[model samples]
Target: MKANKAAVLTVAEKCKNILASNWQCHLSTIKADAKGSKGEIYTSKVKYIVKRGKPYVWVPESDAHNVNAIIDERGSLAITTPFPGPLAHLLKSVQKLPSRIALTGDVVLLKEKKAQLATEKLEALILSEQKAVNELSYTVRGVLSSTNPVFTSRSENLQGLTDGGENYNIYKFDLRSCTYLSGTGGTHEIDLGELQTSKADSLAPYSAMLIDGINQSESRRRALVLFCFTYLNARVKDAYILSLDRKGTDVLGKVPNPTSNEQFQWKEFRFTFKEEAPDVEALCCQLVEMEEEAIKKVSSYSGLG
Candidate 1:
């Protein structure tokens, strides 16, 4: 595997290992634009349990709304916890290293249950694998500089060292260092330096047009799905455009029921435009027409009209 690919996979496996041992994690759902600007972050506490060696997350019913919004909006999830002793020692050994890193993951919202029922059942069957549950696979990236001070301050407070009980530290991660990836298997290392200077329109003409069109639309997510269905001819779930360049647009989402097991896995779809869209309005019109055609095709196939 390539270096980037290896890095991503390592992060995913290590995260699973950590969760399996600790069983408790902090989950944060974030909504941000392709440009990495202007977004909201919501956090919830959740339990991670290992079943049949696979990790499954259990969220309280009260937190379901936040989690579902993440899936519907094609937002990102940041799963974090204070570094365990072993992990913290490893990180501390590296000089000039980031205080924190954020990993990108795919979140599948499992069936919901009442808080009391979930708690009781989980307590009883803690060692067994449940039939259906929420889960994610994540790729990580370092969040430099800005994170260190806050983590340091939180650590001092947590250990009661500011008042000098002992010279102890327990770092805490904040949501600001959120790392959002495509969620599809492919991994791309985001150069934070470049993000500071690059404009959204720096992408290819068609790529730029599509992103801008959807973003400007009254219903951005709806427009994105219609465009994919019409142009790529694929039914996608939890879809989001990751990046666009002169060559094509990199999309991330799940194909509904692609496997025999009925489990959805994130996949990347790349689309190249035959001709660049002239402008945002033209792109929107094109998408609307595609949606209409899609509806007609469904109507014809189902013999409903």
Candidate 2:
């Protein structure tokens, strides 16, 4: 049977509190066939920890059997105290074996016994994968919500990047390395690599080019900035693409006031192509780099330096 949202949240809270008190929990996996007719059951003892208010189940490296099989067996997880403890009471309360509990979090397989924060583990996973801009954007949002519950509770309609009531002139950069006269009546052949500052005034034409290439609405642009930066790094206030070229891209944005939502300061970041020039993969690398930087900054800020 499908679990409702209220049931999921209630179970999550109960699991969190149980882990906080017991430091470990028994995880029973119930696997059902594709037709939802019959199933098998498996059980394991896992160390549990609460990080940023979320409960994560950790399986040690020494474990002989892999839990992935059961976890992937198209089933729900029923968590309770281990045998001989309150297991009887727990099972009696549910009135069912392999009870369905919908949990929204992660399962970590650890190589070492040392306990690490969930945020740290997530950052490590994201960095190791080197996800592209679009993938990184979603991953950053997930990390933000998982690490900071308060962020998810904030009003969704708050003013942000797209709300800035200023008209922006967009520009595009040419792929070639040569100079060409401007189309807007200006006689200047621009060498993209030689461009220095990514400041709005300095990069007017180039900025316009990057902005024009984006097909998303203004609201989406604001949401993208929040997803790609601020949400990933609490220190980041905003993010905006300044320019894009075959070799690199520049971004201009803001850093939030950790103390107040009404205050934010502007900042700029540049990403150079990691792969060969003119390849679409280069853009992917650049976007991944942005996410890596945000993760790094946030990690350091949290005293994980």
Candidate 3:
């Protein structure tokens, strides 16, 4: 139940960042009165959106979890960070495991004005984020755009917000407690107040873009090696950017054995920014400055400065 008060993002902020980046969760709930299944707990994968410190999901009225919500309002959601495909090579390392979070709370169906407003907000947010349908190919996008019952019926049900029509209903999962498991095997209990007030990392949504771009560019990729050599004094090869946040970035590299130079070992290095960046533009500027410093140090050491 200890908290990592010194970490860049408190346990709560990391939780919010992971939740906002991912749009789906494993939802679990108790079963309503139905024959022998009456007190059983059921788990299902569902799409959700975090709005104003709350997670909301749209489900069919007849869905088992929805029915369960009517009788027992207790529920929980589990979310895990997805490891990017580019980093698949590091999968064997235990230190590179994905971070996970579990939240327990009350599951209540929305009503009246709240339902109406949540519907509008949910649709707008989902469409804006596009995480739900971001993988749609051109053909699939075209099919969904056409006049079809599959598309039309879903739109109709979505419009019937307050009453939920005959098909769908909206439910809000109110957060009561949270547990966060870090990538390094540490666990912490998040404070509800911190969870309520913390904002998701500003660069989270675009972090993948940044990492991909750096890995693709030769000069940028070499900059990582140069920085490690200059600051950490470690000669490395096959280095790549691992993760990025507002405060700093993590890089993983293969270090060669000094004696044999035949065996290679993997090591992780962190570079903290001179100051916290408010946006990507500032972040890039800080990195460029660091690269310049690294180059100067390397040149001076080689007596070429």
Ranking by TM-score: 3, 1, 2
| Highest lDDT scorer | 3
Q: What's the lDDT for all of these models?
A: 0.38, 0.35, 0.70
**lDDT per residue, candidate 1, 179-198, as tens digits?**
42323333434444433333
Off by over 4 Å in 2: 1-236, 255-269, 274-277
Which of the two, 1 or 2, has more TM-score? 1
Which parts of model 1 are misplaced by more than 4 Å? 1-235, 244-248, 256-260
Question: For every candidate structure, what is the RMSD over all alpha carbons to the true structure, in angstroms?
Answer: 22.1, 25.7, 8.4
Q: Write down the TM-score of every candidate.
A: 0.28, 0.24, 0.72
Per-residue lDDT tens digits of candidate 2, residues 30-59? 444445423465566544434333445544
Off-target runs (Cα >4 Å) in candidate 3 are: 1-7, 31-33, 36-41, 60-63, 92-95, 123-168, 215-219, 256-265, 299-305
How much lDDT does candidate 2 score? 0.35
Q: What TM-score does candidate 1 get on C-alpha atoms?
A: 0.28
